[model samples]
Target: MSTTTQTAYLYKHAHPFLPRTIKAASGIWLTLENGQKILDATGGAAVTAIGHGDLRVKEAIIAQLDKVAYCHPGFYQTDIAQDLATFLVSTTHGRMARALLTGSGSEAVEAAMKLARQYFLEQSPPQKSRHHFIARQGSWHGCTIATLAMGDFKVRKAIFEPILPENVSRVSACNSYRGMREGETTEAYVARLAQELDDEFQRIGPDNVCAFIAEPISGSPLGCMPSVPGYFTAVKAICDRYGALLIFDEVMVGMGRTGTLHAWEQEDVVPDIQVIGKALGAGYIPISAVLANERVISAFKNGSKYFVHGQTYQSHPAACAAALQVQRIVQSDGLLDNVRNMGMYLEQSLRGRLAKHPHVGNIRGRGLFWGIEFVANKGTKAPLDPSLKVADRIHQKGMSEGYDIAIFQATGSAEGGWNGDHILLAPPYIVTKSDVDEITDRVCRVVEDVFTELQERGDIREVDSRVESRKTM
Candidate 1:
């Protein structure tokens, strides 16, 4: 296909300046129309856990299509949907009771928010104080108006601020690298962040809060940063004290991306409601789901009214069938084990290569989901100017070098709302050791090339000067 045709035919995620037109994809590689082979290092925003072009997933989808492709959940529930729900609940130790599927992660988040509000109505007092949702400053739930307003990133919400919803309060995120005070212990930092959450609830009036939503492992906004130990335990305790539900947005970090079936599994905290997507179906088909435990389900079961929200395409048969097979493959192949092994190698490779880079201020993540934070100076921990768009430049360079990596950037995580830039690297769970090595090598080269190009263009001083400054500190 011609470049113009490819760009126009597809509602491209971004503009076509850096054209990445793919003719086909298989086994972690995409072939462009120009015959360039691009290694999918980030798995298209960490969605491809089983790698590209899986025969089993394709077969499942085909089989589902033969039976039914589009059946409204309101009118009929297919057997495939029921089977997928059973599989998902079984994977969670049968603790989860009900499943509500959606077309994407954002819809799942919206459902969770709505369900949390509905659950409050079923309470003995039928609390009306549960209107505000307290989310962290650097947390990302989804792109819906409710989710966007709950997040700390200002750029995405700037254009639609007038139409965005109100009543979502922001608090300091559980990012020790950014929010923790100097000389603070891990436990102290956890307590401090939890206290800040509680304070927000108090300021909003405890009775007016519905839930505290967060990602178990930070995605995009704070660069895949996981909370310090005991952080979630403290947060859960505070939420219970205030009668607010705790919602975990595991859309990016869950589904074996973090060496476990769920990122919250590693944290030892159970959420009242959990939102999962992306790798849930491994990108064979679009699917997302929200799981409610017995407590949350009981509220709905005992309530007089029906759960008041749903999508026409909720639990699409083909999507659920593909997801069922995708999840089964993850278990049968022991891919979570692979993620553990490969994640260690990936982490080592990243620290080994970029640990000393002048701009790489922090390298934090768990399992296969990693992020590298960039900075203008190490001593003051100041970010590069937002106008530079350093992350965007690196992404383009990396793509030109035949690697598909997503650049997750956010300003405001460092000092305020416009001072941070970081790129997230969440490779598929099925990535091999060789893939890990190549990813690190390509990333290091891209970082080097971009800095050199910037210096040549007189964008900044010597690149190594920042590295040297970091060493002295």
Candidate 2:
């Protein structure tokens, strides 16, 4: 079939360039229809953990289909579903008591929002007035209406603002790289953020706030930025003081993408409601989950005895089976250790190679999840023009050129959601030292080549004179 005929029916996002059509993916490489073998560097937005084409996960799905594939979640329960739920709950170490499976991360966040609202209604005092949610600036919870209201991703939420709920408010994200002041200590930064949240609660009326939702490790919109030390503890304290639930979105950074099983574990805080996806099913199936703490679950059990939420495929047997086997392999093969070891190696290699690049402003992340932010002036931390689409160029070059690497690109990470540009690198947990070396090499080359081309074309300008002056000083 002609390319035009094949792509005519598909409606894709508007872009200056069209993306390649992938024919197949195996392990950490994707084979494009044009005969290009590209390395899967970011796991297609940090989704794949165990890598592609696992025979065990395939067999598990087939085995599940042999018995039962589809069943109404409300009327019937499947053993595979039950097993997967149990496994998810156990990961929280009794902090979370129940799991609600969903089709994707957005669905899980939507469920978390509903559960947060229902939890307040289920209380003895019945906090019916507590319907508002507080999320951070530059946060991306999801794309659904309710989640869009809670998120501050301007590009995605701008047109939908009229339809989105108005009960949500925002606070600055705990992004130390940009949020921290010149002389601010980490403790001071945390306290400032906490006070900002407290002030927001007061403005919105604490009694009207149902929950404060945030990603343990900031995802897409913030480019994998982690909070300062003691940040979550301070935020949790504020939530507790105001009697509001704290929801953690671990969709991108959880499921062992970080060194820990759960990103919040490193922060020393337990969330009232937690959402996990992406690597949970390791791309073997489309699945995500919402895990509620005992407090939230107990409130529902004591009041309604139901979560007041349901989907036709909430607990698909085959999806659960695939996830269960993926989790088992992760544990049996000790992949978390690999993630930690290889993560250190990758971090060292990246910083050693690209940290001093003229446009590289910051490089930060945990375990296998890393992000490299670009800037027009490193000294001033000034971002490139948003119109330049620096991150998109790097991503396109990596794929099209001989680099043959796939890296995830993100925009609007510096200030709210406008000018910042960054690329996120989240390789599969099963990646080895050699794999990391190749990824680092290709990434460096891509960035350097892209910037060199922009400079030659006079499309890029020099750093601000003030920033250059500061460098001289």
Candidate 3:
């Protein structure tokens, strides 16, 4: 690609010298300008669920465009928007009766936070309490200011410390790999974390806490981590005791990415408000929504006022149309079964191929979302320094091998403020067994090749820098 041509847009996430200019994309594969075929294993941040160039979704968008391209939310509601709300509500199994559509996941999260505040204002003891939100450390809700403030990714939050909202609090994430004590059993770990959350609520005064927000399956930020047994049940109990709402963010792992339509379903914990995105429109268009349960809705339904948030593209006709088609296709085509089967295959393949790799510390995931944690030593569980850019090297090596994967790097995971890197894999739901095999094989090859290159350059060291895992404290 010429510099002049690339100058049309400011591309981030990579350097200008090694730009991977894409020309066309089709089911699970992308064609580069240089004619290199790249397998899109990560689906460009796990957004492409039904795969690229899906004709059904394309037709749906075109049909919607023919009818109407846009409409204001406050004035009128279209059928597509209404139908999507109905479909989303039905999927919630009556736990949620109404929905609010947004342009993206961050907007949905922002709306959810406001909705919680509004709900409290409408309840008895109205305006009497609750201005704080408790979120788990290392969990990612979104990038918007409020969402970022609501989360506790220490590294990501460090730079914006001065400007972030002050009413947000954080608890230790339920990452079994890092949260479980040296000799503690899984049950003990759950009980401990649950107790800790309860303590935090009480310490802050239950009436002063608005909600407990979390990612059902922790996404890229923490390597697709999930809570251990009894964690959600305990968390739910504490929230109920405090009269705080539970908000689940399924931006990256929802909409059938986790076998179940909603990631929270597997845990058997129903949240009062659920934020869903990414796979919602299957990358065909930008769309997201917040599902509010009956209890929360009652606060507004019985109140004298309506929620005062709005976006120009809220419930956009074209985006909603595309998502509606994706939903129908997912159900009619029975893709959830495929997700379960392929997810199992991917997990088994990772264990068989890379479990014993000296530098590969952990392989954890569910459904189509997987993560490979890199370490300096497996037994001691030492992390590669952030300055070494181990995750970026592996990702570049994978790209060299014609595979595109996302490597999410976070500081403060290895220690209180130390950095750790992990490469995340979220393949399109339509991935076949062969695709899974190829993905694992390529990932393994890249990991080995990167390590070999480091050794050749005398960059692989024997220095001792072991520290406690971030979540333990």
Highest-TM-score candidate = 2
List candidate 2 segments past 4 Å from native.
1-5, 14-18, 462-473
Could you tell which candidate, 1 or 3, scores higher by lDDT? 3
How well is each residue in 311-349 modelled by candidate 3, as lDDT tens digits? 899999999999999999999888899899999999999
**Per-residue lDDT of 311-419 in model 1, one digit per residue for the tens?**
8889999999999999999999999999999999999999999999887889999898998888887766777766677888888777774544444434455654545
Q: Per-residue alpha-carbon lDDT of model 2 for 158-196, expressed as tens digits?
A: 877779888998999988889999999998888889999
| TM-score of candidate 3 on Cα atoms, chains taken together | 0.94
Candidate 1, run of 10 with poorest lDDT: 464-473
Off by over 4 Å in 3: 1-5, 11-18, 401-412, 461-473
Report per-prediction Cα RMSD to one decimal.
4.4, 4.1, 2.9
Best candidate, lDDT-wise?
Answer: 2
Q: Model 1: how far is 440 from its true place, Å?
A: 0.8
- All candidates' TM-scores? 0.93, 0.95, 0.94
Worst 10 residues of 3 by lDDT: 462-471
